[model samples]
Target: MTKIFFLGECMVELRELDDATMGQSFAGDVYNSAVYMKRCYPKLAVAMITAIGRDRLSEKMLSRFNSEDLDTQFVFQHPSKVSGMYFIETDSAGERRFTYWRNDSAAKKVVQFLNDDVVEQLTSADMLFFSGIPLAIIEQDSRVAFWQKLEHLKLAGVKLVFDPNYRAQLWANKADAIEQFNKAFQISDIALPGIEDLNVLYGISSAAEAIDFFQQYQLEELVIKDGPKSVVTLTGTDLQSHKIIPVTNVVDTTSAGDAFNGVYLGARLSGRTVSEAVQLGAKAAGTVIQHPGAIAPLAAFKQAMSEAGL
Candidate 1:
């Protein structure tokens, strides 16, 4: 079995059900991808690598992981801190607005749990995936340690996938985000970057500029995504553009990019062609955007996958 580890946070989510109602759930960037990937290819060994607190909400989080079929071997528990929480407000158009209270979340100290044995386990994995959210949230010294481990894993032939899931609030300044994202791009084998996110960080407005910017990095595969537009992919010297079938009835745009990242990587790792993977990703994103949250209903996503022949 091919083992892949996803390194990030899993926060408690509170979303508005209506003016006087709310619903609670658990989700984060890499956590969403890990769950969707496992659902897409159940035989693949999928693991979640992060820390949670010993609290009621943390217990719920762990249960969610188990129910989603994500491996919990690398999920550590902290004594004092608790999991982070965020509130979401959706407009009439289903666009999401977020308010976060995650400054001292247990996952911030996740690197403290990355002792030698954990590092060794990650190195033995077939792939490791993360995003700019984790890069921005972790402390600087701990990030140094984590990057060292990522380098070691890269040297051991573990494919490193990075998604620059940028949020302006998570980072202090654009310069720091650029510096940290550069380090991530340097060590990554596959990079899934949304051009809109990069526009804020790099002043890049179009896929051409984004692709040219990535020319500096020695990436095996690079994907530049723009919502409802053609996606651009670069592998070696071959570049291809894929037009996404626009979803006219988008309910929520929260997990569109995450869905694409999950199914595309899942398909590629399962020996599908890049075109096939992109098709699956696009179909999955179309379905997810028509739903209402970051993690869509399992049956809906699987049905989309089946429709796409994923």
Candidate 2:
């Protein structure tokens, strides 16, 4: 079985349930992807790498992971620190906004606590995945060390998949974000970036210009997602565009992109063609947008794939 590792934080998510209540769940960019991927490909070994506290919430999170059948050997536990938390506020249109309280999260200490055993586990993975948010949360020195480890892993023939899930609030300044994202692109074998995120981060103005910007990295594969519009893909010198699966009722767009990344990568790793993978991704995203929160139930994803004949 192929071993896939996702590196990031899983935060306690709070969303308004009613006029006087909030609903709680666990979610994060890569964590959401990990869940969907595990659901999509049960035979594959899916694992998460991050630091979490021994708090009750963290315990609940681990229990959920176990129920999902995700490998938890790589999850590190901190003695005193707790996991991060985020609150969601949706507009009348069901578009989501977030407020975070994660500066002191245990996941920020991942690099500080990585050991030789952890490095070996990462190096042995068939695919190692992470997002821009993980880069933003860790300390500067740890970021350097983390990237260095990634470089070593790349040389050892481990495939690297990077999702530039850029959030301006998570970054200190645009320049630093650009620098770090560029460095990540250089080391990545595959990149999943949203055109809107790229335009906002680099002032590229147009999708063509944004594609050109990423082309400088000479990645093996690239997927540029444009919300409700077409998705563009690049393989070597070839480029193609695929339309998004139309969503009739979008309840919340919280995890649409993450769902797309998960299904697309899962399909490709399962030997599906890029076009097939993209279509599966679009279908999954369309299904996810019709639900609330950062993770739709596993059954929802399975049903989406079945309905799409994937």
Candidate 3:
């Protein structure tokens, strides 16, 4: 079984329901991807690495992870800090707006809890996944240490996958985001970046420019997502574009990209070709947009795959 380690935060998510009520769950970029990946590939040993607080909410989050069958052995508990939270509000068109309450989240201190055992756990993984959000949350000093550990893991043959799930509000400034993202790209074997995010973050006006920028990093594979449009990809010297399977009803676009990342990686790890993986990823995201939250039910994912003949 493939041992996959995801390093990031899992926050308390409150989404506005149709009746004006709020539905609560646990999710984050990498965390959402982790959940979907586990559901897609049950035989894989999926684990999450992050810090959680010793609070009731944290306990509930742990229970949810366990119920999802995700390994939480690398998860750290902070005695005083609590988990971060965010509120999601969707518009008439199903686009999402977020309000964050993560200034002092326990996940921000994950680096402080890292030790030799944690290092071993990370380095031993077949693949390690993280996102731009994880880089944004950790302290600057801690980020140095975190990247150093990732460098060692990469040297040990653990493939690194990164998604530049860029949120403008998370970074202090554009320059800092660029710098950190560059550092991350250098270590990533596979890069999953959204064209919209790249355009906004790096001022790249077109898909070609975005693809060219990532190509400079010499990644083994690059996947660029453009909502409702064709996805651009590069594998070695080959460059290809695949169209998205459109979703007629998009309830929430909160985790569509995360869903794509999860299913795409799962498909590839299961020995599917790049074209096959992108199709599965597109199918997964198309299904997720019809749902209301970051994580659609495992049944929903399976149903989506079946409907797509994946």
Candidate 4:
């Protein structure tokens, strides 16, 4: 079985309702991908690498992970630390704004849990998936060590995948974000970045410019997703762009990119062609945006996959 390791943080989310009630859930970039990927490839070994506190919210999160069939052996539990939390509010168009209270999240100290044994376990994975936010959480020295371990795994033939979901608020400045993203790109075998994120990070206006920018690295595959327009992809020297099927309505756009990344990579790794994978990605993303939140119901996802002929 091929093993995939996703490294990131999962935060408890409070969604305010009309009746002045709050609904609790968990969400994060790579964690969203992990859930979908594990569902797509149930027999494959999928593990999430992160830390959670010894709290009820954390326990709920672990239960969800088990239900999702995601491996949690690599998850660290800290007594004093607390799990990160965020609150979300959405308007009529289902566009969301978030307020976070997560400074002392246990996942921030994730690097301290890394050692030779942990690195060995990570290296054993066939694929490693993560996002830029993980880099923002760790200390400078720990970040360097993390990068070194990734390089080691790459040399050992592990495929590195990254979604450069750049958040300006997470970094010191634009310059720092650029520098850190550059490091991840250097070690990455597959790059999945949103068109808007590329524009913000590198001032690259179009999908063509984004692909050209990432061409500087030794990346085996690169995908730049632009909502409702087209998804531009580069595999080796062959560049192809697939037009997105127009959606009649969009209920929410919260996790469109993550859904695309998950289904796209899942299909490709399962032997689908690039064009077929992009189509699946677009279909999955379109369906997700028509719903709410990051992880849509299992039935909704299955319907999307069926409609896409997956």
lDDT (CA) per prediction: 0.90, 0.88, 0.88, 0.85
For candidate 4, the TM-score is 0.96
lDDT of 3 by residue, 1-310 (tens): 7899989999999976668688899999888888888887788888999999999999999999999999999889999999999999888788988899998799999989887677876777899999999899899888889888898899989999999878888889989998999999999999998878888888876678987687679699999887888888899988998877688898889889998998899889989989999998888888888988898877877877878765
Cα lDDT tens digits, model 1, 1-310, are: 9889999999999987878998999989999889889999999998999999999999999999999999999999999989999998777777889999997799999999999887887887999999998898888789889899899899989999999988888888988999999999999999999988899888999999998999999999998898888789999998999988899987888888888888889989999988888888888888888988899998888887887785
lDDT of 4 at 207: 88
Residue pairs clashing, model 4: none
Q: What is the C-alpha RMSD of each candidate to the true structure, in Å?
A: 1.0, 1.2, 1.4, 1.3
Error of 3 at 299 (Å): 2.5
My TM-score estimates for the predictions, one after another, are 0.98, 0.97, 0.96, 0.96
Off by over 4 Å in 1: none
Which has the higher TM-score value, candidate number 1 or candidate number 4? Answer: 1
Residues 1-310, candidate 2: write the lDDT tens digits.
8989999999999998899998999999898888888888888899999989999999998888888888999888889988999999877677999999997799999887776667876788999999999998898878778888888889888999999989889888989898899999999999998877887888766558868788678689999888878788988877988877578898899989998998899988999988999998898888888888998876776887888886
**Top of the candidates by TM-score:** 1
lDDT score, candidate 2, position 270: 96
Query: Candidate 3: deviation at residue 66, Å?
Result: 0.9
lDDT of 4: 0.85
Candidate 4 lDDT over residue span 157-259, tens digit each: 8899999998777788989888989999988999998878888877888987887788789999998888689988899888998888867777767778878
